[model samples]
Target chain A: MTSDSSSTAGSPEENATSSSVSGATALQDVSEYSGADDDLQKEIQTAVENLECCQSEIESLNVKVAKEILKVKQNYNKIKKPIFDKRNEFIMKIPNFWLTSFMNHPEMSKIIDDVEKEVLQYLTKLEVEEFENINSGYRIKFYFNPNPFFKNEVLVKEFSLGASDQFVSESTQIDFRRGSKLRKRLRDYQKMISKAKKRSKKSEEALPRSFFNWFVENAEDSNDIAKYIKDDLWSSPLQYFLVSDV
Target chain B: MTSDSSSTAGSPEENATSSSVSGATALQDVSEYSGADDDLQKEIQTAVENLECCQSEIESLNVKVAKEILKVKQNYNKIKKPIFDKRNEFIMKIPNFWLTSFMNHPEMSKIIDDVEKEVLQYLTKLEVEEFENINSGYRIKFYFNPNPFFKNEVLVKEFSLGASDQFVSESTQIDFRRGSKLRKRLRDYQKMISKAKKRSKKSEEALPRSFFNWFVENAEDSNDIAKYIKDDLWSSPLQYFLVSDV
Candidate 1:
């Protein structure tokens, strides 16, 4: 790193004065040595260059250290990725995982009426395609085994409940036969909400007591409703729902 | 860094068994999948290879991280070297730095007689060429201005005191006038030790009283004496004897 031909050599005269300034910045002020001879000036310049070289080398080393730290972190993540993937594989094997969990929740159970509960027994599969509290809202997909009342087995529905401040939206194509188990459950949910509202002294007093009431009322904002969707406690509750038939 | 042609690809069937195990050692037991078809066996082999590649890459990154840490330390030392050298330059300019410090020490003041004190006042220069308590003995050097009695202006001494269990060695060519101040001081120091030994019931009672006595006696073992020798507090004390006349 030393570029100067005449580097500062320790001698009695050199030890007496400016040679004492060792800080890199102080060393860089080589022009301050106005009285020194040409040889001494060259020596001061050399010292300055040496200090600069040391500073740059230190900077480069710092960058190298940071880069190595990042590489190590990335490799560690790669090693852990497969372990996480393996866990997910095992989780996906159990049927009706999400459906049974929703049915068993105390808050969810309270909101679902007995008629809707009986129909949900025929729920061969329940999947939450999207359940985040983010702007897009929740999309739920339900699958059923061949039943006497419904022609199509899979039913998909989207709701904006409890995710945003806007009114809730339903995107399900409900074309079941009139008076079928699915239609009866759906009509009763609307009647319960309207009847409760008319009977209560205040609109606020019309609170949900069944799963259908919760699904409709909770869609107004994602805060409290979205939190329970991500919990791991409901992981294995739906194992029986995949095989049960109403 | 991956040279593997067949990397682990997650497929539905592959995810069905323990083929998801990503550790290199566990993946090596691919033969256990003998019941599976040829295609499945190939897929397992690929997964094992991918895991081994990941493990090796992580190992290489670890080595890189260690090397970078060492480089940073080496560069840091480079920056400190010049600062230390500059400090030494300033320290060297003080003429009687070490000597005056030694004369002022409370332990050193009591041992030197009046005549020796007067002679030490003439001290002009003092330097410690080497003072490490390593395998080799400690080496000390002193310089003085022209005086009324001494021919030589420089003196050199070596001591193992406070460093090892051995004798102190004075290598200086001390050809002073027979009764000169330097000779008197030396003689009195030996006399003091012997006199103290004779008068005291125990030899321990004649322990070092002055810095010189301490230096001479402490040389017997490095313990505490060797410690202060390296301290900047005891600068140069023997500088005066180099020029004093008795």
Candidate 2:
């Protein structure tokens, strides 16, 4: 058995070459035989096992890291919930917060329908998802409860904060009710934006006109709203109120 | 009145100097007067108002951004909860999984008490708190249910992922009951670690000793436990596991 073990232990290739040797005897030689061959085989086995253990430990560590990330996310949400709920409540009380702001922008005013002002309401929620350094920007989803005016309740916009041209795109798939005034207003608004883009291009600034920029620029209403919108409870979403029906 | 308005409108300084002028006359001159002074005053007023509006709009936008961040955090938490719960369920069922692996580690075996093995159990939960790009690391809080061994049910460890020396520290405020064997074990473990640190320092490799490193290194087991601890569900706190009944 000793001689057989030494002979078999020459190399993995030699082990295979000993075709006459039975499988059970070979395994016994490696596991139980008293020789340097057995020690070498055991060391190899332990090393292989250690390598496997290292891989598994790393995999386990990764899972743990992922779990930690989720936990951190939950903690952030826990801290943010009450503040967000208060914001939502305040927004709900004040009608047309988002819409008024959207229209108040210098550029958006050119495209938005004046008549649609009466129909607009406050956004139910606005959520911004950050992609961190990889994207260096955020995407926001605005939610509105279903109303009589438009069926497309959700509006999504992606902004690349790092880029010179910051606006990426915004989309909303509205389902206008049959014979709704919004259907006409939507068409008119799209045309207005297209015209604005063309007109601005012809002028000194050839850059493609951004509707978001226009909305931000035009949304300025300083008088009564400014005085009324005093900075209050650090939590309440509305530090100041803007006076507008639409 | 026109001449007075022009005189007053020469500069904002002039307007201030003409304090002797009657309020009604000044108002009358500014509003009903002719020439660029009235126009200049009105333009100035409008510009100031617009500046105020711009500031307020920015404030409003900040609040909205905060709200959006909260919403995104909530979304991440919502997605993570179920997966975490499932992982908890699975981890709860596997008794002594952590303890056996810890003991299996050559370094950890030098420190962990043999008697304490029977009293050990799996962790109930782990939570991470993120500091984002500023700190760029996470702090984890581990929760363990009340058990017979010790009173301090929570253990916290902070890891700075970016730093060259990553382990910050681990702490636990354990209140041992009188005549408890765990008190001796805890003291012994601490002493063992201190001694190990001293001994390792004297040797050629003066690498700082990390308890976390011992836990991580020794927590590796390549047998059935490795296969059993496959990565499937993503949320489970990997920490010290308690041994089964002796």
Each model's fraction of native contacts: 0.02, 0.00
| Model 1 stretches astray by more than 4 angstroms | A1-246, B1-99, B104-106, B110-113, B131-135, B160-173, B201-203, B207-226, B234-246
What's the lDDT for residue A148 in model 2?
A: 73
lDDT tens string, model 1, A36-125? 777866665664444334434434444554454334434544554454344334333433334455554644544556666565555655
lDDT tens string, model 2, A25-68?
33443342234475565653443333233334434444443344
Q: Write the per-residue lDDT of candidate 1 for residues B1-246, one digit (tens) a residue.
A: 111122222211111222122454444454556787888667656644553454344344444544443354345435544544443343344334344445555444445556546555555444444333222334555555676546667765564432222334545556677557656666676787677767885645534354344434433332244334433222212221121211
Residue A178 alpha-carbon offset, candidate 2, angstroms: 2.7
Give, for candidate 1 chain B, the lowest lDDT window spanning 10 residues.
B10-19
Please provide TM-scores computed only on chain A for all of the candidate models, following their numbering. Answer: 0.44, 0.42
Best by lDDT: 1
What TM-score does prediction 1 earn?
A: 0.28
